[model samples]
Target: MKILLTAINSKFVHSNLAVRYLKAFTKDMDYDCKIREFSINDREEKILEEIIKESPNVVAFSTYIWNIEMIKRLSNLIKLVDENIEILYGGPEVSYDSQNILRELNGDYIIEGEGEKTYREFVEYKLQERSLEDIRGLYYKKDNNIFFNGKRPLMNMNEVVFPYEEDENLDNKIVYYESSRGCPFNCSYCLSSTIHGVRFLDIERVKKELSYFIKKEVRLVKFVDRTFNCNHKFTMAIWEFLINQDTKTQFHFEISADLLKDAELELLRKAPKDRFQFEVGVQTTNDEVLNRINRFVNFSDIKEKVDELLKLRNIKQHLDLIAGLPGEDYNSFKRSFNDVYSIKPEEIQLGFLKLLRGASIREEAVAYGMKFSPYPPYEILKTKDLSYEELLKLKKVEEMVDKYYNSQKFNNIINYLVKQFDNPFDFYYELGKYFDKKGYFNRNIGNSEYYKVFLDFNMEILKGDKDILNELLRFDYLNFNKKRGIPDFIGRSIKRGEEEEIKNMLRHKYSFKEYYLESFEIDIQTFLKDSIIIKKKDYYLFGYGGDIIHITEEIKEY
Candidate 1:
């Protein structure tokens, strides 16, 4: 059998790892696998023509909320060209309402839960000319009838193949794998329910996967698991293995700080700094808001664990908060913000509550009198508890988070001066509010305008607070928006710091080859030396098309 695994990613930058998993799962199976990825950049007609030409025995689509509508359109178009081609849809987006999705997408077969065994079963049945509706993990629509054998008892992951063990060298690719599935916490506006429940993949198998990347010299491995810290034993085992290996390859995991045990913290502390990054969804600290959304939070413990981790100075900890959530009015949101802000994470990702499809909260949104956009994301416009005007105010605050908080360019300045207020949210909120009134922060700026705004904003931040002026001088260029000549040039090695911001300013002004000579590392000496000019010396520079050096920050101050 021939299979076409297509993934239409939500964005250009993100690679579609599902197809890689499909290819790995079907490696030994009797089939010809062709992996094709499409994005907003790809021409639609060209992709459609290719699909029409290569009418394979099976067509699999990995679904997500962002690409569902597009997937439906593509599936319809594919059916128009070849109706007999077997279409199967899986992934979180369709895992919840398999029957409806099967009918709607005109899919002959749908795999719920893990795709390895279920997808293999799909191919085997088709190859042997057997009825697929009887497959344990499959939901199928045939003879104008829908059949579901219910979900397969989630795969014994040990029996499964490694997600990237095939003919292709994945060293160049930013590989993603899950040590576990399902989230333990059931935050109301979350898709944890849709995934059914948590089942950890084999740790040894996960290590083997990591081992491959180590041997292959892949620089980064991003764990797609939700709440990586949920399973203490599993988390420890994986972290212990990678730490012991001492490979240059780094691993990124999203964890729940509240659930992180002391032992887990110790294990994490042992890992090489900058090699591991954790994103904790500290949605809100307001107890009422948390309870309204069915979230169980140990605020005190969460604070201590996060702060301790921040003190580690090795790992990058990104803490998150949601602006629009149930029981969170303007004042309540500010309290939540300030509470989270007090911890002072390396990065604060200000996000809005996206009342996603198949989420528990969306079901009871009416009870909360929530007015939300009727879309895949279904973001809350406002709830009875929170007015629309206040939500709009929160939007401005979110903009501030993106610019100063999340972008992290203003970290030095923020840390230096934002100390007078007890509530950090009030401090940030007031800052964002002040900027909007000044007409300094605009959505229309491009290149030169961007720096003008950045510098101007930083200068304003310094005038009222002189303590932050020196902090502003230690700029990391990478924190600003940047585009390079080569996509995936540095991949995960690049951090949003001065190096990147400097690189961006150069590339936008010149070209890559113009500044790039030898490979460069951004150190303090190089940063200050590069501040002056050096010609005739051919060496790698820090920024794109610039000279290279790595000097510590203290030297510049001295």
Candidate 2:
């Protein structure tokens, strides 16, 4: 019997660790098993064609919130082509409501919860013509009645197979590895909280797996652990191992900042720059909101740890906040935004709350007056504290944040604006309001247009000093890209002869041998327009990629 395990990923770069794990665990089973993966962006017809070509007797799909609708459609199409084809569904999206999924979607079977051992057993039962009633975690339809054999016990971590050994071509794609399963904290909104306890693989096993990835120099190995730093000793051991390896492979982890011990922080500080990235979920700053969601975090301690982390300037920190939640109104959310923004993380992920199935928050939605989209993500439209109108406003704010703040294109400009404005939220709110009023948010806007819009906002709305804004914009623009051509709105150009003179001076000052002149290479006209020429006591030369070199006056010791 042929069995095909598949997964529809959110992106092409994301490899489905779940499907790979399932495939690896069932390798030795008495059946033909193959793993196929496709992205949500892929056309349905193309995906259907590929699946039909496989012509497997059984097709099991790993489902998630992002690709459930697509998988359902694909499953229906597969059944239409061949009625004998058995369709099975698994993963978190269908794990909780297998019965409903089987009834509504007409799926042939679902292996709920931990599927490694259960799937092998089910496949063996089917191949050997054995009774299906004995298989645990198997929800199958027999004689027009659905039978749910109770959930299987969680498998030991050591028994779980290593998925990557068989897969080739690991370069560029994100390699997701899990050292542990489940979470320690019972955050009401999170699906990870559904699993009661945490289980870990042996440290030696984890180290061996990590060594392979490090040796291969994979682009990124993002830990799929619910809370990576839940166990301080385990986390430190892994961190120390990675640090010692000093490989090009960068590791990413979702960790609780507040839980970081002093020694752990010190160890992290010692690690190489840009070698690790930590995604800290500070969902909301309001203690009341946090408490309502059963998310216990010491905001002050988290801030303290994050501040300490920032001082090192090595590890990339991505802080997150959820917009609509119980007890968090528009004003309260603004405070949360400003509070997190103040810490100045590498990226501030402004996300909306999704009422996921089996999550405690979804059950309490009615009590909180939560109205959500009746779709896959089930994102909140409104709640008791925040209205639909207010949520829409936040949506606009999210757009602005994504375009400017999160893009890291306007780094210096954002820093300057925050200092000029009362708070970061006001800056973003005003910018979002301006974008909405001008109808900029309705369609696609390019990077150049974004710069123009910011300039317009600064000049027209804020009525800031033109010279200072221009200087700040110049600094911000050059930090990211090479000097190609300066926009007319920002500055004016110099004469051809004068431009030639400045270029010659720059060339003489920064020899091709001493400085990396290739990156600093610019046409005379482009250099004249883009370079900021400022008079500070004496005439100084400033190129886009280099520091100001004293041209007229001798350099003085500080």
Which number leads on lDDT?
Answer: 2
The 10-residue segment of model 2 with minimum total lDDT is: 516-525
User: What tens digits encode model 1's per-residue C-alpha lDDT throughout 400-514?
Assistant: 7777676665554455345545656656666667668777676555443433444455456535532223223223333333434322322333345754555554554445554
Off by over 4 Å in 2: 490-558
Provide the overall lDDT of each model, using Cα atoms, as 2-decimal numbers.
0.69, 0.81
| Candidate 1 wrongly placed segments (more than 4 Å) | 194-197, 415-448, 454-558
**Candidate 2 residue-wise lDDT at 429:** 81
Best by TM-score: 2
- TM match of model 1 to true structure: 0.78
Clashes of 1: 20
TM-score of model 2 relative to the true fold? 0.91
Candidate 2 clashing pairs, residues 3+ apart or interchain: none
Span of 10 residues, lowest total lDDT, candidate 1: 531-540
